[model samples]
Target: MEKKFNKVVLAYSGGLDTSIIIAWLKETYGCEVIAVSANVGQADELEGLEAKALATGASKYIELDLRKEFVEDFIFPAIKANAKYEGKYLLGTSLARPIIGKKLVEVAKAEGADAICHGCTGKGNDQVRFELAIKAFAPDMPIIAPWRVWDIKSRDDEIDYAEARKIPLKINRETNYSKDKNLWHLSHEGLDLENPANEPKYDEILELGVSPEKAPDTPTYVTITFEKGIPVALDGEKMDGVTLIEKLNKIGGANGIGIIDMVENRLVGMKSRGVYETPGGTILYQAHQDLEEITVDKYTAHFKQKVSLELADILYNGYWYSPLTEAINAFVDKTQENVNGDVKLKLYKGNIIEAGMTSPTSLYSEQTASFGEDDDYNQADSAGFINLYGLPIKMIAKAKEGSL
Candidate 1:
């Protein structure tokens, strides 16, 4: 005996897993499946999705253009917090999951669907991310994770299942790397990437940019303007967040910027190796940091480093809607109040070299920092300060000498 539902709303992507999931839901539950796909800047992937979903036994297909919202509400906040998982990953997939999950709940509630479904696998962190978000919004809503319950054990098994039913797949055995793409980044996992010792064949798998060796000979310069820690312009041309990122992606990619290969610890207690391309995001982060260096004070900047690490863990673990995350964002927002400035960067051979930075609220005073005579700082005062700081050390040395 098994539970039954009259209708289910699935977080659909029109990818191989979700494509087969639509049919599986129909066959297993004998219910009307509404496929909801959120377009978080996955270009070309959403084309003809409605017709495909309907033809594959879905009762309805809903595509939501969430690009602007994703950038503003999710991505920008992560930037302000300088959120980086393990101080390496820019959290491209981590940031997109909550918004997508929020949309799934909304569609499910509107359609009066009995449950929400997703194609996230049990082994990956996405299942936790998706379900946590779903639970936050709709506490009682049942979540059907196909990868957990289904008999399919591997990607090959999924391909076989699709072939048995004549379902078309975008990837095959030869090029079956699992991927998740958004405006911020494109990630590649599985296949050769599963082995940590194997060097990634970037030329074959990279969709976002060229490798450093293949980059252009000339260095490309980009000036990013930030207001309250949010990127507002590139090369002095004012634009919205989405447009700014899009433009930088082109420039950074052409200059061979923002490619990373790492083995990250997943929330599921396992390490997974993946290669990520985040051209635009890397540039924005570097520029933002450059601005903060001049604008933010030493004490606050040091504390924010710890906050960045904590925030990264929270976001990576799918606690976006939690109270602690909200509080951390509030603090981060306050810090960004004076983070207004410009950073000029030189991109060449997979490096972001800071050419210059300027800020109206800069704490750096050249006269005070100079080695020459300065009226603001007295050299004589440091002797007294050092004596006070070294009091404990002096006492310890005296105590040992007396015994000798």
Candidate 2:
């Protein structure tokens, strides 16, 4: 006999998996299923989700618009840290998971639900991300992952089950490709992406931007202004975080600025090939780094690179709420205190070229770095500096030759 739940709150996306899981939860647990959908800027995907959830037998459906909060809180912090998974991905989907998980736990508590349900599959990293956040917030709440416990094997089986129950679904076997979308990015996995050697059908898969080869021949110039490491203005107009990103997405997408295809290591101990489109996010990341080049010192910048790698790993593994991630973020925030400036970039065919950068606190000195002589510097000082720097190497060489 299956364990019974009085009421279970489910993370619903109105997608193939979650749409079917809502009915399955009600049938298996004999409980009231309350569906919650978090809109983190998945533009068209959120349409009619409430009606669909209710039609599929959910007791209630809740939609939370988290676009502003997602950008200001999650995306900005990751940008400040320069968090990139495996040096390519902008931590788009990885970052969105924790926020969704946290929100789901909040809803579960407010509704006084006995358990929480999710549709993450057994092999994916999302299962870990969702469960870890849930554990962090509500340690004792009963967690139900239907994909792991369900008897359904594949997409075909799921479709058949949904068809037998007459559940309304937009996805079919031929048109089905696993996708996740948020303001920061749109990620595509499974289907033809399962085979590493297969080239992605860009026409069918791309939703945010065009292919690099099809981009316009003429380059576009964009100016972005940052105040203390946070983007404040685009092309002289000040805007809020969400609006700014939206505008940039249009601009960057047209120039083919951010499209990535890679085979990444999942936290669940497997490799998955995914195609990601992150137009605005890629432009912002590059602009931020360009501004930092002038404001941040060499040693701090080098150390932050290591910190960024660690932060990326932390986010990828779903440790967003851990104390270590907090400490690292604090460090990242401190470094950004002086990262204020304007960065002008040229975008063309998926390339981000830094045209110029300026900051009031820049360490660069034109006079000191010039080839001509200056009163502040002496050419004779370098001989002593080189000897001191190479002392260990010279001593080792002398000892080997018995000249010590």
Candidate 3:
């Protein structure tokens, strides 16, 4: 007798692993499988996913549009904090999984699934990301991961199994590198990138960003408007979150703005090299940081940038479900209370330069700031203020003199 599962919901992407797991789950557990995919700006990657899931023996398939929520809820919050991992990475893939996982639980409950299955390999950060979300929402639900439980050890083995079973392989077998793409960014990993000596092939590795050499000669002047820390307009045109990103992407891509290549440490304990294209995200991040510089106070602004690094680590390491992340987000929200303004940026080739910023809450007064013509500052007032501020230095000097 087969160990029974009445129904299972899988976070299906219609990728190699997910495609294979759909058939395996039916064979192993003898259960009805429901495939659910979250559309977090994956573009055409999601095309034919529903038909493919049904072809692989799924009882039903559900695809929900989450691009707006992904931007407003997850991406905007991170942008408000200016979260970037390792001072270079933008955490594009990091913050996307939680939204995907949260959707999995909701679908599973509606479908009456006895368990939730995921296509994530045991060694990667996604397995932890997916499972933690399942645990948080449905603690008692049985979790199944095929890579951990099954005997398949390599991609070749998986392909062999797929071929014999007649499941059409979507990815070309000869293409060694794996790529993940979405509206926010696209990432390339494995194969030639695994070697540090090899420079990435420009022709095969890009989608959004243009080659620097191919970029137009003129610098692009762009303006972004934000309200209460969320981006609302691009280049003076008031647009929704989705439309705004798409427009900026066109401009940034033409100018080669957001292209990143680096070797980063994976949460699973390995050094991996990857190339990323974040055209729209790069522009938005630059605009957000520029706004913060003018709107936020000195102490809060500096400290929030520091907090951003920690936030990047958590999001990248799949710790989005922890208490620390909640606390950090609360702190970030408080800091963003004044992060509302318009930022003018000069975009040239691959650079994002801050031109100027104007905010109603700006502490910058021309009379106080300008040395050429400033009536607000009394020159005599500085003498007493400096003396009071330097008192500790004087005390330390006196103490040293007495000891000597």
Each prediction's Cα lDDT score? Answer: 0.93, 0.92, 0.85
Descending-TM-score candidate ranking: 1, 2, 3
> Model 1 Cα displacement at 106 (Å)?
0.8
Better of 1 and 3 by lDDT: 1
The digit string of per-residue lDDT tens for model 3 on 185-259 reads 888877788898999886667787687777899999999998878899877788988788878888998898899
**Model 1 segments beyond 4 Å from truth?**
none
RMSD in angstroms, all models?
A: 1.1, 1.1, 2.1
Candidate 2 vs candidate 3, TM-score winner: 2
Best model number under lDDT:
1
TM-score of structure candidate 1:
0.98
How would you encode candidate 2's per-residue C-alpha lDDT over 173-287 as one tens digit per residue? 9988899999999999988999999999987888888888888999999999998889989988999999999999988988887999999999988899999999999999999
Find the 10 residues in a row with the least total lDDT in model 1.
Answer: 247-256
